[model samples]
Target: MVSLVCTLRSHQDDVNCCAFSGALLATCSADKSICVYSARDFSELPFSPLSGHGYGVHYCCFSACGQYLASCSTDATTVVWSMDTGEIEAVLEHPGRSPVRVCAFSPDSSFLVSGGSDGTIALWDFTSRTLLRTGAVTDTSIVACSFTPCAQLFITGSTYGDLRLWDLNMNHLHAEKNAHDLGVSCCQFAPQIMKGTDGCVQFRLASCGQDSLVKIWIVSLLSAAGIKMQLAHTLTGQSAPILSCAYSADGQMLVSGSVDKTVTVYQANEGVLLYTLNQHDRYVTACAFSPTAPLIATGSMDKTVNIWMLEDGSGAQGKSLPDEAASVLSSGGRKSSGHSRLMVSEWSEEDVLAWLREEGLEAVIDMFKSNNIDGEELLSLTKETLSSELHIESLGLRCKVMKKIEELKMAPVSNGTPDEYLCPITREIMKDPVIAADGYSYEREAIESWINTKSRTSPMTNLPLQTTLLTPNRTLKMAILRWTTCQ
Candidate 1:
């Protein structure tokens, strides 16, 4: 049940890659240009068809914030463009001066790496737009590269049929010599990390190859013997070489394009093929999933990019987060439930608990949890039900709880808390705000998780931390407490 919503026709030559951020979709092609389009309606941006590359553009990717885009080209350089002005931010020449084949940004948008045909990899300090370091892989061309969710190690795939893992200092950690017989075409690490029993860390990565196979592997860190990679699944849906593969934002689904002129979507964990799309007339070169929408984009040698909507059991269209955010923007800062905000009726059980804890209503937390009360349940609560059902004998307590609920209903859904009240590490409002050495405040748990991952860098600056010490931000905490009380 895959249906093509629209076909983009901006590229005059073969489209090499297509990437989507939360709000924008960008496509690179052999036409020596890149086009930017609105993810909402597929309308071209006014500054699109960016033509700065001297040679053909091969790949493009967006930063985590969707504020910038990086594109690699046969011109032996990677160009970073600002999404705000659609202007070039910086041009990084490949170290070996070899034609740059691929590029990837760290999850935190602190670092950018470009892979070159000469097996040279250049890492850039994204904050300063300067080269941090360079390293070489096998003699063969470096074609694919991606960073793990931790942002500590990265995997590179080369035409030599090896996938090598390396740390930030360009130190070789591990290598899989037989990753693909003919050579790896593309590789991507899943966005989400899973914790296993006994404090083990797990990551999943999917790679497509010229051997006409898509392989998924389990990457384990903190293993007794060091890092480990185990083959998890091998999928064979395309008859010809699989060129590109990508995981959906949630990492539940995978999609790949192939020389067979088709795109295959799979249930990643189960290795089950969900759909085989055949809209492209020529070889399918690239494929990507929208991070904020139930949509997939595929590019082909036919010089077109096709957008497909992922429908659920029902045929109703699910709105993209960017579209909702755009609505909020158009309405003059009414704001959308992008991250810092959630509608009263849309809060999860945990969100409700967070609210209760912030409002000093912890005595009723156990009761609310036991009853499985959620956002929807909270809205329907009345003073009568509170006293009779929950057996709240204190009239003042019931009135206070009801007052908080009333404030929730009357206030604009997006008007939850000030952005400063939220931790930079996690978008949610901070319960325990602590000042880090980087001079930024973050939630205790979030910053601790960031440090435990050994990223050991400021999530805000992407620079090395001078100290791991976290000081309590009592003043800010008190201010948040006062604001909540007023609300």
Candidate 2:
């Protein structure tokens, strides 16, 4: 069960998209404007109502670091905005003059990709304010685009009811398949790899269409024939077209918004319906989950956005059978636990490895290096030896070590490589990089703040700037994006 925490009413027209960036939330609408609000209180920001689009804003997304926001419109332009100032940093226009329907930022925040109604896909270096490439994706409009977790691949959904996978280079089509009977409206990659039957590992993608069905795909890049995608599951319950779908950060659950004025939640792995939320008065347009919180934000054609908190089972008001009776019911009255018992009893090293990989803990060996322990040494040490050296009881030390391992499992990997594409002030990779008059490029927001609040002088050098205007560093931005793709 879930409960609505807040209902925001600011957009006069339909709210098309909603995205969360830590404590901040951004929403765009058919009112031809974008609004930013504090997620903590749902208060509109002082510098919000960013209005520059010539037509209705169709979609908006925050950069991975939340420093920049990108929105596409029916006017055939995609504008990148600095979240710090709520000002446009760059404007990207497709060469074909097609209305951009969807846009997405790569995981590294180095590239912005937009798909348009003309079936053209445009890749832009937002930091440089330059278009990197434009290619045709389909004969019909593209409605959604999403990058894989690794940022190496992207998938696009089209009005032709097809889903296509493309390489990050924007030069090759990896795979193409007819995905739905009606136009595909939304698509998203699962935040984590999924384990399927037969000990197979797969990258999962969820897509919803006007056909009123949501389909989950299993993509295998290691196939003998190269990248391949197959339908894994079809979730059929929505009576109207689904407008959006999203996976929770940990990939345990999936959520979808539909034209039926309802939102649905499902168990991601099993496709089990968990709950249905019918709080909106009109069609639900977009749905997203906070990356670090058990919160969901849904936008609707009713011109409102609602925030909901995912509840635990303790809050569920349902009766359940006793353990023995429940077990019998689940097992069809069998005395033994049957195949489920065999699966648990026969867990193997392969299964353990699979679980670790799925949990993003495959780099545990690297994580242990901070403690001056090598993989070899750790493997050689016995429980007694470890306990004696640490001066603790064997069981206590084992428990503590297990807890420490769990903590380290979520620690970020130290690649030790400095990102040259980062802003000098914020120390984050630049999402809207711009070059000032002093021949140094900084993040758009960082430089704008320096010029507007601190001083008109260049931050890099103490020289006074003759003009506060900045130029887009298109070449370096494109170079950085290409470099990131290779990485």
Candidate 3:
């Protein structure tokens, strides 16, 4: 199996936010500087370090085309930079005691949005760098905000656990209320799917605070004044407080990184936990789904950044690797027959259906695929269609299903590795602790699979492992690690 790949040593201080423009990665750091690095290689050094924020740069993002970059900071300022010239185009300064907590460019690239500590959201014209609109609700700081794909709507999450929607055209408040039990951390609008179909506008937002839970909200309400949106559904539960979340370009998958030192993927609407990325050595500060690829890039307090891909049922063997690293992705442990059955039932939806479809029974499988059909033959179908276009979702699903099938069809419910069980790497026991792209080691591929398995299938990956720092004087050690690895 190939292991996940990570480009180390990209930032100096904590990397608060990350965005991509083509092959370039724009990162904001607490060191009060923003660096643009070649996404292709970190060893090459930054293209340039644009410095200006008086304090730590809080957040940074790229324009749709990636030609421009935007960064906001505790300095109460947001600066715009042109990647081509490596120069600052605009400096946004607002009056108030609050820091410019968050800033974002509208999808259209015509405007930018910034929310501050005083609970105010400002919309600005990029060309004029002038404030166009403002929405003030709670007195608490507005922590997260995003403009919908269409650019007419904006949503903000606050320290009070409430979320508010604003109307850009009307300059009015549209919707407001608590989105979770605690302060909200991040909010994101789903990409527009189906070229022309605007069914129900859905936005997936994640909120966290003292509460370790990460709640997902689907908004459908629209403001009568001009904005349109409605609250639909929410999903909760994370090993730690979630700090950030992003949806892949396709919108079929969402990646969330948390203070919990792990990253988890959730099905947008169903709120199913597809995988638990237990790899970071410290709290994950930021995560961004690649705009055009299957990669999920994560930054953490551990002073490292990792790039991971969602795998189908294939196993750890597909992970990029060395012989010593080959076994990490395929690692597994004592089999829990009952749990295995549940996991296959839950995480195997995409796999099961694809198998049935290949067998000419596509329309007959239930949503869960739990019917008592001939299990062995059905699994073979998964292997057959894994590489074909008819199969959907990420390739990770196929890999997962294929593994479970091998276990179910060949062995009894014992801890012993089945006769067909072969490490995708060494083709041996997923022994000697497999390390994931995120940096932590897994007991076995099955263990990682179980933890990362779709919640609908495996539910839980075995009581969750305790995450502790690998170094003494963790924070200082991380700073040094970041500098060394990145340089």
Candidate 4:
């Protein structure tokens, strides 16, 4: 289980991204600033709210040793900050004044790689504060880039939905492919490797895009064809475009954020959804799992950052029992000396219907009713009969059932009227609310439109706007959710 532990409210505008360096949490925003906070208590650091970028900071990352911090911005520059002193050590810029969108530090922390809107990728030796090399991976802007564990190879994802593999020297393209239907927004390598047959190590690459799908690829360092790559699996569940993805330090879990306003955790090897965190009311733009703890940090367009704590023993916790054993439990049957018999024959149709309703299995009940099957029939039906007669394939049905079960298990059941939750402007339950400069809350879209086109003033106060930034009112939102749950 994953539960929201704290919400950080410092960014005046949308929180664009977040990262973790040991016990420190860093977040960047459209306010052209970055803030550092304590991951343990969500307290703002003394030297936080670092402001130097001329434009919105798009991404931020920490070096392997957590000694240095790097942030890329639309100001066409990347700033390297000394974490200890909170001082700028170096500022690297693109030659064409193109907006820098993504950056990564090499595993050894000796070099940094950055990609920008001009389709250029630059490598800089941080120790010397000098650009080592520059090249273009595509004519379109590059949106995502990351170095492999070995630091000899890195991958870049482009706005054109192309994925390219590059050598460390940035002189060779090992392979390239059209990986997604829309812009490839994020990519990361698995933190662990699988040993191949010939003693070579095989790694997995995960990429998400505007296509609302996550694709996994197998990359082998030593193949007969030389650095072979193949599609491993495709995960589909998010309703909107995915913005970011990251693998846990142990590589047993994968976490993804989407514009669908949810963060999903998946079992790395099996590609199964373990949890769906839905506390954010707007697009979840960035997510990162802590390298040393069972914690996750997420930033959203809602203008808030949330830290989630995964329960102990819950990471990548797969099915509890084998397939045969699960079947036996569901049937309420006990194994004899050498045989098994149905033990639930005494359950009546009404009793079974009540149980199903209690368990939120209305869909299954409807299916049974459509087939004119009763409680006794369902209890006695064999697995083969249930599948064949209901025309239900195991894979698809199993996924749906598992997802529903997990959701029900984690969600707090609620029943309440909508009047108290209605937005002041929309007069309906607010899906995403923002606090304007007038000290009043309104739906984000309604307030943005009021400020942009109508007038440069507060709709509620009719006063000239002090600032255009809208801060998220997460406190009220949480209160409304809790009120509904207790009703």
Q: Which of the predicted structures, 2 or 4, would earn the higher lDDT when compared with the native? A: 4
lDDT of 4 by residue, 180-228 (tens): 8867999999866687788877888999999998888888877456787
Model 2: CA > 4 A from native: 194-201, 314-487
lDDT of 3 by residue, 255-294 (tens): 7778867777776666666666666667888888777656
Question: Could you estimate the TM-score for every candidate?
Answer: 0.65, 0.63, 0.61, 0.65
Model 2: per-residue lDDT, tens digit, 15-57?
8999888878899987677989877766667676788986678
- In the range 156-178, model 1's lDDT, one tens digit per residue, is 99887889999999998889988
Q: Name model 1 segments beyond 4 Å from true.
A: 314-487
Worst 10 residues of 1 by lDDT: 327-336
Residue 215, candidate 2: Cα error in Å is: 0.9
Instruction: Give the best candidate by lDDT.
Output: 1
Cα RMSD, model 4: 19.3
- The whole-model lDDT of each prediction reads 0.82, 0.73, 0.59, 0.73
Query: Which pairs of residues have clashing backbones in candidate 1?
Result: none
Report the lDDT of model 2 for residue 311: 65
Ranked candidates, highest lDDT first? 1, 4, 2, 3
Candidate RMSDs in Å, in order, are 21.0, 21.6, 19.9, 19.3
